[model samples]
Target: MSETETCDLFVIGGGINGAGIARDAAGRGLKVVLCEKGDLAEGTSSRSGKLVHGGLRYLEYYEFRLVREALIEREVLLKSAPHIIWPMRFVLPHSPSDRPAWLVRLGLFLYDHLGGRRKLPGTRTLNLLRDPEGTPILDQYTRGFEYSDCWVDDARLVALNAVGAAEKGATVLTRSPAVSARRENGLWTITTRNSITGETRSFRAKCIANCAGPWVSDIINRVAGSNSSRNVRLVKGSHIIVPKFWAGSNAYLVQNTDKRVIFINPYEGDKALIGTTDIPWEGRAEDVAAEEKEIDYLLAAVNRYFKEKLRRSDVITSFSGVRPLFDDGKGNPSAVTRDYVFDLDETGGAPLLNVFGGKITTFRELAERGMQRLAHVFPNMGGNWTEHATLPGGEIPNADYESFANTLRDAYPWASRKLVHHYGRLYGARTKDVIGAAKSLADLGRHFGGNLYEAEVRYLVAREWALEANDILYRRTKHYLHLTDAEREAFADWFAGERLAA
Candidate 1:
């Protein structure tokens, strides 16, 4: 039999929460091992609405604590990773038939003040008839409200967390699933199998953290053979990508007839990311896809407010994700609480921490609090530190992305404006590592379409754990949106061939 490796912590799942916990625990001097069934953020983490905001709508549910924590976290996350996270303005067009003006104003006021509003600007009223923001709006909606929120590259956020954890001496294994776990001799014995290599590995961990998101219940019952009173409610949220009809960088939030608000955000420089229906999901999380009805429902909501009407054909692509909400016995999916709950099951001498229902906005806080729950286990571990620490590649001086980008442009005078912007936005201070000794565009090697080059691909594979072409084309970078079908196929072929050759 193979030797059983040992660690202080064993983390299941590579979603945002797991990655965050691994990074937090590892930074605090705990030996950590994180195993993911698929690529990092392949689940719900990458498929979020991509906002780090105080859930403006959650205030209706009276979730003040969650909203407040998330609001405060927005600035913290922005400072930590300015490259993938930044401020975004949301335009909410007023509809008399939906929410009353006074109620909307009150919500905005609370949203502005609730979390100790600092760097972001306060809300402003807009005349849809006169302002350029109203150009795409219908004549009926004459008033609008604008507020602040932060946008994040959800996939990149997870990747950075994994990177941060690895840098802190945590073992991060992708494409490896924890198949079974059992308590043995006052410790948890976990067995994981690598899907690609068909190699099984065993570990003896002092404790286990189940951050499987939608698969939390499965991990608890099936994998760990543990029981918890807490349950996860799977709610499906879907988003559609289409050509940008509106002309501004600001996003639009319109109220639907059902009293739900849909966000039409600017995406990929030229596309609009419109989302999200809150429907109770009963299917397997992996099989979840944007249904035709959901797509039509989204188009109808946007068309009701915008002057331009979107059709079925206008939808370029769509995605769906299941939000594993902590079941609060709410009848309405929309009314269900977004707050997270932790279940610490110490059945025997071993401990199993099962995390349930957390949003991307409060992931760091969740990790910090999760670690606190295990403080007694690691009494000598370091105190809170990530609050001010920057993630990998986020070490831009003063957290000023624009200033850093300007410096990057100066350093790479031979690079194109678009290429420089790409590297600056994605790699930040690590742009030099990707560019290396390349003096000009020719040094970047074969152009695979858009801003993707051989050098960038090599860097992602060598540093970011990018094994598949989709990892680079879709998640690591949005090159899929920019590349032609033929170009994408050609790139995939090249990637597969190169991998085989290696």
Candidate 2:
């Protein structure tokens, strides 16, 4: 048995909510430990639709509070992490067969005004026949509307939160699962075993935060031996990556005949990300995959609106995530609320806060509110600090990304514009830390592929808890989509030989 450790709070998930909670708690002067069963954001957090929007479709369900909160959070996050989260224009072409044009206009009006509309521009009507944004659309559709939303690098958001938590004195353990947690003498006796090293550790925590996402109930019932009347509805949404079909940077939101809107967003410079089919998933969350029908359905939706048609072969890759939604007694999975619910089971004074069904957009607010819920448990904790604080590497002056990019270009004139942009976007003010004293590209060491270099890999392993190649390629950065099969294989071989695990 390992020596028993103690912490003020034990967080049992590495997704957005869990990381957000850990970061908030740690910053509030609480000794925290965040243990994840897998790599950070390897689950649903990384596999989202990659937008930080107010959920325009959610308006139909009358989730005004959820949309308003998310919309407000949109600007908040954009201000904090300007490098990764920025404004995006979404073009929605109106069709007579689906939603009424008047209804769409009404919703857009509400969306613009609901959140106190700041920073981002308001919606504008476009004549598809005359506007350049409409060039990709079919000639029959003459009118469309463009609205504002923000695109996010979802996985990096999780990593930055975990980084912030660790920096604030939280112990973050990746690939370590809390196998057991029991209430003994008004304290949580928890045990976590590292999956890689096969090492076990014990802890006596004052409280436990169950932010296990899709496995929220499993942690409550199996790990903590606690029960919750609140339940999570496992709704699986899938997305596909295809070559960019349109000519612009703007994304398209097409209304499908089934009443679900599918997003075809620009991705990876040269590719387009199309997705998201809302289907009820009964199987295990880990086993969720993008079904062929879901892919076909997305293609049909995009093809209906665009002149260029997509086929099965055009799909470069696809991914799916099982959303752990708070079951609101809604028969339709799409109709389920994206709002988060907190269940604090304070039996024996050992509080266990269980978070359920939150979207990526509202994670910071969710964390703040979650901490407020635990105010009784942590009376000495600090006040809300993340509202204005920036995440790790998001320390741009006035959140001006263009000015920062210009500075980087001036500093590293030897580096390509593409490489500088990569570092600027991913590392932001920490770009110098990654590049180090390198005066030229050669100082960056062996180039794996794309903008990926040995220096970046080493930096990720050292700072971001990247123990696996996929953790670097897939999550911390999206070099996987840019690198070729040969480059990836070569990089994996190099990573294994180096034994970079700390």
Candidate 3:
């Protein structure tokens, strides 16, 4: 028999929403327990296009409210996690065959003004023939519009939120699935099973928040034995990674023949991230992967605008994720509203808050508003604070990452430029904790290919709930992309043996 722990909130799922809510709730003086069936952000969160934007395309659907809220959140998120989120300019080549020039200008105008737009710049017209951003663009694309949005390391964002929650006294359980939850004696009883340890734990919670992304419906019906009037519409979006072909730091947004848009963003240092197609998905979310048709479609879209042609062989890797959109009866998956909807079921004196349809940009706001909905249940919990609070590793003074990086370089002059960048970009203020008392490269411990050292691995295991190599390789860092296949296998073997010995 396992011991039962009591908490004020039991949050299911470890994606951005759940982690954000747990962080927000714990900071508000509420006891929080967050459980994930797999590693944090293993689902939709990690597989996103990885942008903290205002959903500029949503303007076409007249989703002004959602876009405005997300737009405002862009700056807030950038301030909170400056280490992981930074400003990026997007270049939209004018396609006379698609949207009219006047409509594009009008949309860009609303996008510029709808949000507060403080740190980021406004939209500017571009001469594709003259501007450097247009060098890779086809000659036919003579005119373009450049606008601002922030890029994010989506998995790290989720991990940092979980770390923030734990720091605020929240319990985070990864690889632990909520097997069953029920309302008993005016409180919800939830049980979780650890997939690795085969240990079971019970928790009595006053409220349950289902932020299960694609599994929201499953948690409501199968796990909690409850139902919601709202249903999640699963839409598949896929992205491809290839060698960076375009010059400059700006991203490209091109229109497809089908009236949809595709983003070609600069990724990692020398790679480009291109995506995504909106297709109604019927298969299980876990089984989602990029198909050949989607790949060809994305290639076609990019080839249509750029002078440099990309073939299937150019793609290094591809990934697909399901969007748990709130069904609005829209026939086209592209037209489905990106807005979120919440369903609160308060029967039998216990409440189950099911979250449906939310984007990464609006996650913090979603968590804050979700807490507001439970204000009556937790009358004494503190008011909203995440809006102004800094996330883990975002403690750079005044949110200036460049200045902090320079200071870090001066402090660790012994470290190479690449090594310093790896630590500064990922750990920020916590870089010292990772480096510890190490004075030299040898002091950092065994080298595991690239800039990944034993020091960083030890730090992640101790603080960030990193239990496996993939957690560090794919999610915590993009070391896998840099390391050779043989090196990755060797590192995985070493990690497994170390964990076993422990």
lDDT string for model 1 (327-346, tens) is 99999999998988999998
**lDDT on C-alpha atoms for all candidate structures:** 0.93, 0.95, 0.95
Question: In candidate 2, how many Å is residue 95 off?
Answer: 0.5
Task: Give per-residue CA lDDT, model 2, range 246-303, as digits (tens).
Answer: 8989999999999999999999899999989999999999999999999899889999
Candidate 3 off by > 4 Å: none
lDDT of 2: 0.95
Residue ranges of candidate 1 with Cα displaced over 4 Å: none
Clash number for candidate 3: 0
For 1-502, candidate 3 gives per-residue lDDT tens digits of: 3989999999999999999999999999999999999999999999999999999889999999999999999999999999999999999999999999999999999999999799999999999999898999999889999999999999999999999999999999999999999999889999999999999999999999999999999999999999888999999999999999977888989899999999999998889999998999999999999999999999999999888899999999999999999999999999999888889999888989999999999999999999999998899999999999999999989999999999999999999998998898888898999999999999999999999899999999999999999999999999988899999999999999999999
Query: For model 3, what is the alpha-carbon lDDT of residue 154?
Result: 98
Model 3 lowest lDDT segment of ten: 421-430
